[model samples]
Target chain A: MQELVEVRWHGRGGQGAKTAAQFLAEAALDAGKFIQAFPEYGPERAGAPIRTYTRISEKPINLHCGVVNPGYVVVIDPTLLSPAIVEGLSDQGILVVNTNEPIEAVRKKTNFQKGKVGVVDATQISLDTLGRPMPNMPMLGALLKVVPLVKLEDLYKNIKAKFLKKIGEEKTNANIAGIKKAYEQVRVG
Target chain B: MRKVVAMTGDQAAAEAMRQIEPDVVAAYPITPQTEIVMGFAQFVADGRVQTEMIPVESEHSAMSACVGAAASGARTMTATSANGLALMWEIVYIAASTRLPIVMPVVNRALSGPINIHCDHSDTMGARDSGWLQIYCENNQEVYENVIMAIRIAEHKDIRLPVMVCQDGFITSHAVEGIKLYDDKQVKEFIGAYQLEHSLLDIDKPVTYGPLDLQDFYFEHKRQQAEAIKNSLKAIPEIFAEFKKYFGSAYDFIDTYKLDDAELAIVALSSTAGTTKVVIDELRAQGKNVGLLRPRFFRPFPKEKIVRALSGLKAVAILDRSEAFSGQGGALFAEIRSALLDEPKRPLTVNYIYGLGGRDIDLQQIKSVYADLEKIVKAKKVKDLINYLGVR
Candidate 1:
């Protein structure tokens, strides 16, 4: 059987890659898929590149290992465009990179010969909207456009479940606005 | 009824502990073993089980917390692995010698020098002399069942020693498999109430815990603890029978598979036995006489049973993960050789040190183990054979 629509998140350690993976799964979990979101540990001090995963399926996941093959590879940091991270992009997979650069340049660094490439200047979008250079919210918006399994409403509901509990409503609304602007600026394949 | 789900060894242990309803569980996070503590932490967070979960800063604090909790007359539990267990080395013996029935799951990992994390029996091997009732599980399913059974064995009126339900670190702790948890009613009925009244902190009935027991009175107390630990030998089978009557999972303290007429046997503990069984069966199909003797409980090591089981075999290979620096063989080899000394007819026993420092042991290595067994049976002088899951 085709398993969960698995997505791999690539970013530097301080850049909220694990948070992005978790929020993606939580958003889709509210849509009723049994999801597993986990971060693979690394030397993972402040700025080391980190890899994480989000898998959304109609069935329970028994495998807790890394996402061996992914449906979408979301690179939160464009500098992490290496073959090591994108090694197992499934034939029909999509690569979403957060950079103002051309799609082919990003594609040149990856062995993902079959992925439909997406490029977005998420830092500029986040700073313009949320006033922080958090690429997670915007990269997620790009991810939603490419993978469309989860509705926009479910993402906010799940984000509120996480952020609203930690920060207040004002910061949550700012994040939601950042996500909204991301939907407008984040490129579609 | 408590639900059936696919879970790792640690998750199953946490769930089963909840089902049996321990009063307090204090544990700290350590790799391969962290999952168990995290599982219980979630239980404490969700309030699915009404057990007090204490989060400690380190393994020493975790064991210390468990000692305090158990002394206060609560059925307390905790978990650790490798160096973490090493860190708790002094306290583990104290918990056992004091006769506190705290059940812990030691997710066995390699002890560190170069700092690695994976599966091995070396950690528990290092703690073999610590007097804890050690029960090594062979699979994810057994890890769950053994956690429940360990509590029963540890808490038996005759046996008040703390039990360590051990499994190979990531191999069992992180590997997901199918397992059924007992319903609260069944587990509650099976384990019954934890009937102890020695609350060290109770103002109404004041008591002292861990007061220095000098040789005279303390020696007898140590003897009594040893007696309690030994009494588990009988209780293990009886409790297993009762558990089988309810849950239909019949287990032996020492499980002997096809040793009946086998010429050779490979003995192992923890998750290695699962893959070893497959090797045993494949070799059996080819008419090669090989079997697995996986001992579930280790403290009151089934010395008589092992001697009796090996009576008919021509050769035995004892696999040990922990090194015995001063000894001629690994610790397990010494124990097995010492136990079989009284047997009238015995096999030529060999010691094979297969895994250390969390090296992966696959079915290929298992198959290779059988070939070594064949050679040992033929020669009877195959001592100190190091099976290299590590060398490569």
Candidate 2:
């Protein structure tokens, strides 16, 4: 029974949170760790709130239910930083959010006050590097900075392998650049 | 070398189908189950396998096409969930009664009226008496393996009946997990080639299928079908033994976790069993005598083995994901209680209807169930025989 790290992601339908969870899980698998990733399914509309989950362990994962008390909570949509998003986060949990605001200001605004919080301007990074505001990969960058679930190089390699053929070299490179920027720029409070 | 990859349950089912390369796959897209057929469809479009992929308009037509194809001696498969399974209700029974040996992957979901789409056992439980062999899976790997075993179990010479390998809908179907796959050669060798004793396509031996029968002959035909299902109880383990020899995982009609010498135990199915296992481990660390029995073979109902497992327990809680609405208890509870009715050492049985329509059942709720079982054992009376867990 290896230690299991459970993560829950809060984002909107179009924010690619589900994609980020899947990417992290795949990267964990490539790093020789067992992982489980899945999104909560509903009548998803582009801007509607969406929840996704990921579980990483050295042992094969068998529990197949939603991650109620997650070790980490990743908020992809800044607007979803409400209390409901952190409902079941453990006391030692880390809350990572994609926002341009300072970590202290974001914490005060959301009144989250408890866990170790990590904040990054993923939207700004995505816009600067990828020329679009897709914060999914950048958020993953921020998460990796906080938890180190998989090697940074492994995540980059996974992104390249998955998106190189599907989305072409230019977009892939931009996405990777965004992730690196988020990794470097993230601030923990 | 075995190929180990990360895949969702749906993807694994489709991958298994790709490995099998059945003669026909008639399917319609539905949430959760949609990806399974979609993945197989992609394989067909890419010219990976030579399966005749039939894109049916509805689930009813999907099963109908499978029955037609299977009757013509073609190895057939299909997939559905929730309303899709309900839509194919008539043909579901027909495929089994006609003994078409059609193997289907049923992504277990809640049957809709309020129309919520998530994981539950209602859809498959509704078809419990439909004569198809039902195998519940605890994870994506089991879903993949069960589909492969189902092909062997359903097509066994003595048990030529349809088989449904059921997995929890979004929980297993949409979740990505690491799974080891057999090489194409090993899977092919295990299944061998498909054979039909009597085929509609055989010009030499003319046969009629789905013909109308009145009360006189229908009852006997149904009895024979019943006999085939009973024979499958034996055939399933035989296939499981052969599968373990090749794949190296021992699967049985029932799976037990720390139940050899336990006073309190739980009986559950599918993904819930995985959660229950974790709770059992946590309780065992605290020196609680709690264990679990997961029934893989839900159709023939494994009466004797289940009774034997529970006969010594002081209290046993049966968890049902679907409500039987009998005002008494859930479907599983009813069956287990009846199975232990005449046993001299029958444990005090309780029913828990939980996780209906995809409601989440967490660790606390599971622990609470165990606590209730302990209380029931101590009090020497079942205060509330039926309980609802994790509901408002």
lDDT of each structure?
A: 0.78, 0.91
Q: What value does the interface RMSD of model 2 take?
A: 0.9
Cα lDDT tens digits for candidate 2, B1-392: 68678899999999999999999999999987989999999999999999999999999999999999999999999999999999999999999999999999999888997887888999999999999989999999999999998899989999999999999998999999988999998998999899888999898999999899998799999999989988877877888899999999899899999999999999999999998898999999999989999999898789989999999899999999999889889888998899999999999999999999999888889999999998998899999989999999
lDDT comparing candidate 2 with the true structure: 0.91
Model 1 chain B worst lDDT run, 10 consecutive residues? B383-392
- TM-score of candidate 1 relative to the true fold: 0.71
Per-residue lDDT for A86 in model 1?
Answer: 75
Q: What pairs collide in candidate 2?
A: none
What is the DockQ for all candidates, taken in turn?
A: 0.07, 0.82
The list of candidate 2 runs beyond 4 A from truth reads none
Name model 1 segments beyond 4 Å from true: A1-189, B1-3, B201-208, B383-389
Q: What is the lDDT of residue A110 in candidate 2?
A: 65
Candidate 1 clash pair list: none
Q: What is the C-alpha RMSD of each candidate to the true structure, in Å?
A: 6.6, 1.5
How many clashes in each candidate?
Answer: 0, 0
